[model samples]
Target chain A: MKRRDFLKNTAVFVAGASVSVSALDFITPKELFAANPQLKWGFLVDTHKCVGCGFCVKACKTENDIPYEANVTRTWVERYVIKKDGDVVMDCPKGARDGYTTKLLDQNHSGMLLVPEDEIAQAFFVPKLCNHCTTPACVQVCPVGATYQTADGVVLVDRSWCIGCGYCIMGCPYGVRFFHPVEHVADKCTFCYHRISKGGDTACAQACPFDARQIGNLKDPNDPVAQTVLSQRVGVLRDEYGTKPNVYYIGLNKEVR
Target chain B: MKNHVWRPLFVVIAIAIGILLFRAFYVPSDFGSQEQGYTFGYHRLSNEQEWKDYPEKYKGNDYCNECHDDKIEELESAHHGTIPCENCHGAAFDHPDDPEKLTIDRSRELCIRCHAKLTMPSSDRNDIPGIDPAKHNQGEECSECHNPHNPSLEDM
Candidate 1:
């Protein structure tokens, strides 16, 4: 072959190879980049309506296959008794799985006795669970990339991939994350993702007869829970942390943190 | 041109091409961020489906209504209307097909979960009719006198 022709072919091949390197982006499926902007899951808790029945806790444990005997729970209720003297007493015995039939005498283990009924100015139950924050601390702290927030705004932990480093657990401000006794991995609420994705209410929401707990798509204007969240004055737990939690409480009191 | 300059360049280009090819083969097609803004750029896209497929143990009243419409209808009209059927009877997971019948929870503890008197004056729990277990029918099962399907209704 002539030297000139050989030089031209080599130049074209090198340029073509460089151009093909940039085409690597095309290998990734287009669907992975297509974000569904319409759906964003949110939860609402009406503290005034929660009766401390503990049914939601039971349902969550059963639906998620969390060990019944294990003290760890994905969701729980806290009973707060505020004295007229401004001392706030809080306790969540057995994660409120069994009702608050027997009150905890030493809730903080500070050797403080239970305030008598007459000294109490107000008492209420606050159901607590994973906030499924917009900017989740757990997701940010996961070193192994096991925990992530889904497109629909639910934070999920890939149990198989979790290293159980407990960073995510410590990073959480609400103390929602726990190591599964059997799995020995960092675990928390999925917002009952298995049920909610299939057009079913969460196990906790469905078990709540009083309609105190609800899960809904915040993007959907028609959802009653969404309406309540948007139209009414709702508050989230530990807003100062800047996690931007999704769970909204209707009758949240000042005493609650 | 020096052989060293072109030789290293050629080798670097070949290695780059090799790495790209390996990535295409190794990385899953559905492994990446699902959205554009404010998203952590690492996650398995297929894990969403894996979570969605996780079996739900507590099938709500709608599942039971397929067969036990009569019981559902009766409960809906009564005081226990809001309570799920599975709440009292264990989670209707693979019901009738596997267990044939649900184990009815007729324990007094089950009944008292909502009815047990809490002395807190500022709470809404006082709205529900509560009784001290020691004072109310003690030791005897609540189902003996009250029909759990309709708690207000007296059992014959």
Candidate 2:
């Protein structure tokens, strides 16, 4: 190329670089430049500590203002009673609203009585809620970007933007997402986003009378959730799905899916 | 150049430049501030206010701690320190202002939610024991034996 052409090209290149750099400044906001909190919220559920009183379930409904209904739930406790033959009888009658109580079954043709509590090999209450996964399947499957993970690692639903397609409900391996009966949008536990963002615990965790459900910030080294998760044996639900769930269980049983 | 190619190509490039220039002016100056790196239109959703202002049902622990400082201090130092007061008492939406509205859930079922044990895989839960409510204190409220705030009964 001629020297004149080369000079022209160099000037154009320099101008383009300067404009692009300045354009980036406009695109990126000042708040983004501020120091990130680097907080990742997590939950720990101790099954052994859970008594299946269903208070957490009730608390979640109340805290989230979930309308009174049998089908929709942000959280629920499953009572799993494993028989001696390894048959697991899981029940959460009315989401355990009345709590678990022994009910004598009518005698069968063989005149067998209800299986004695002592005879049952094992039983435990596994309280289930949104895992708030690191790589959430619901977020991944969202059709209109309605479901998204915040910078702090809490998965949330943009209800206004959600189409109520129910893709997230089906995509979630933990089955946390549900279509709100009245709102007609896909909804699930947000780890109490409104509360947690203001430095409060999740509704269920805060309402856990026995401290069975605990919410902590993984970013803070002093946070119990961070310390416990690092020091203790924590298990995430459905690890095979590779969702990297933030909700960990302290005494997760093999019987638990 | 082909007879038809030059005219269409020139028009397409002009339109493309026009759109880009228009977009450059249209996008807000603070559009991508909260978001890092380049996204086509990610920041528009970040600017929304609805996500931040959902109707909060639980009034939060701080609200309770404001008026009940003594109870907060006692619970903070007790074995049940981790348990929030609202767990035993229902969410006090208008408490302190309307203290009478706060419902203290002293139901036996409330106590059993965590105190009653079910079997699970063996792991360390710090020996947080559970009792069959029926067997432990039949027909008796949990508060009869153990103080809800100070379960260790040190204060008593």
Candidate 3:
């Protein structure tokens, strides 16, 4: 080959290398957090603002189009009323999707509804969901590597990867994960990563009628979700299990404890 | 730290690749796809009917009528007119006959499957997005309190 031709080819190669190297910078971990170095993954659920409307549950169902066969609780709200005698009690009168509504409307089963008398001088509803723990047992005990913690710190399952093993269900301290019957896979909340990371919020967070649920990036100390966690003496469910979960509940009731 | 910088780069790069390789291949499949395990779920054997799928199934709405005929009639009258049955039940090719066969994938996991779709609350307008489980069913799991058959909680 001529020297001139060789020189031209060399020039092109150098230029290409420079451009390719710079391109990688565009792919930095935006979905991931490096400031904390722990890759924190979790959520902030404000109970005081929650109205027990069940919007999060419906939003999750409609948004994800959840199949009917998975008889487990993914995301849901619970109603708790403690009697003046300190007898703490709770009820899911509006149990699951199509649960109480269909029956109460049915004349045959309508009589079964047990509308609880207000427990406190005034009573309120509290919602519950998967904790997505820091040291999650579900992540640890998953026989297959179906579930894992993302760089952003959210614990989630890849349905395609999940083998329908219920180990995670047993491992979950919050009793949130369920073995979906139809998909035959393990499923739970991804902290609404689709919306949260992409500059949006979660279904349950937005669905709260009384401004109960709030989502935020822990990295940004100014984030509202994080602020809610700080403002309220919120608690993680089953902290004793040592999952170090990200899902936080504010104004939790005796029923939850 | 001049020409020797590449030496540190080489060591870090090699270690990163090694960790990636181990995570990608050496890890067990059980965490994601358990080759061994056991699972038992809710199913009605006595009501062993097939999941429905009509030839003219525009939306799974027809199956809703066949199963919960009353709810379908009520849903038609409610504000939930444009909503389709499959909106909640993903691709019901075979729901009734063998609900055990394919999964409808409910629970909280369903929320973030789509890219860039947000479910954040407390933003004032909860519309543009979708329904929230709490308010929709009034603290009950939509399925438990309300039956998809008729799509109403009139007392169910």
Candidate 4:
């Protein structure tokens, strides 16, 4: 072969190779990353319908295998009493596992003020759980990257990867994360990922007789829970933090925090 | 080129290639940052499947209906129709096959979880018939008097 022809052929081969290598950068297989845009999970709580029965709390404990004696809970209900004199009192006894039986305060020394029956104006209950934020602070603050958000808008903690740094527990604005009594890792509500992914209702949602708590696929427009969330005037807890929480509330009182 | 320049450049190139090769072998194939504009954080892609496969403890009422259709019918017609069967009788994780009989919770605490009254003036809780535990049938199991299936029927 001639020397000029050999040089020209070599140049063409190198140029083609470089172009192909650079093209590979733009080609990322869709299957490698499994973030399904079609599915998103959301939760709704109707404070008006909630009777503070604590059945949801009991079901959550049983379904999640949380220690019955542990002081921490994945979900709880708080009773708020707004006095006639504009004083607000809030308490969640044993995470509302037992029904609120008495009108009087059980523990006076706990620094909780006892509102007189005549002095009380109105009272209600608000159920609390992990907000499962779109921009979760727990996910951001995990030093070991153990806490993460699922593709379907649920936050989960990899117990094996978690180093018990407690940064996630501190970083959460909703104060939902807690140390698992047995596992000794950061744990919070998963919105019952096992149940929901299998086309079933969450334990808490199913146990709620009054239909106070409901979970649904937010991406599906036909879902009743999705319709209520999309059409109704709902509010979220602590919108100032910019977490973009997925949990929505109806008839949330101004006194609730 | 001088030995100093050429030798150092060769070492730098070799180390860069070595690091890339190590990463290719060390990192998991199904592990990486999430797709851009999707998830808020990075995670093992397979962990999503791990969570989904986790076994559920609270099997719903449909699982109970396979055997206890008679009790389900009576409960469904009663006032406590909305309450699930598993709520009172623990989670049916492995029922009948493993443990034949499910323990029934007949304690007063279980009954009063919804029936015990509170002082909420404007809430829906007032709509539920709540009895003061202190005044009404003190220290007696609630199931002893009222039939749980049909709570409206009094044994007295």
Which number leads on lDDT?
1
| Residue-level lDDT tens digits of model 4 in B22-47 | 98996567665675232355767777
True contacts kept of 1: 0.58
Candidate 3 lDDT, A166-231, residue by residue in tens: 898887777778767567777777666655554555655654434566666665667776776767
How accurate locally is residue A170 in candidate 3, as Cα lDDT from 0 to 100? 87
Stretches of model 1 off by over 4 angstroms after superposition: A1-34, A103-113, B1-29, B36-41, B153-156
- Pairs with steric clashes in candidate 1: none
Enumerate residue pairs that collide in model 4.
none
Ranking 1 against 4 by lDDT, winner: 1
> Each prediction's DockQ?
0.35, 0.21, 0.03, 0.41
Taken in order, the candidates have interface RMSDs of 3.1, 4.8, 15.4, 3.0
Q: Candidates sorted by TM-score, descending order?
A: 4, 1, 2, 3
Each model's lDDT comes to 0.85, 0.72, 0.53, 0.84
Report RMSD (Å) for each prediction in the order shown. Answer: 8.5, 8.6, 17.9, 7.8
**Candidate 1: docking tier:** acceptable
Candidate 2: Cα lDDT at A43 = 88
How much of the true A–B contact set does each candidate keep? 0.58, 0.28, 0.00, 0.69
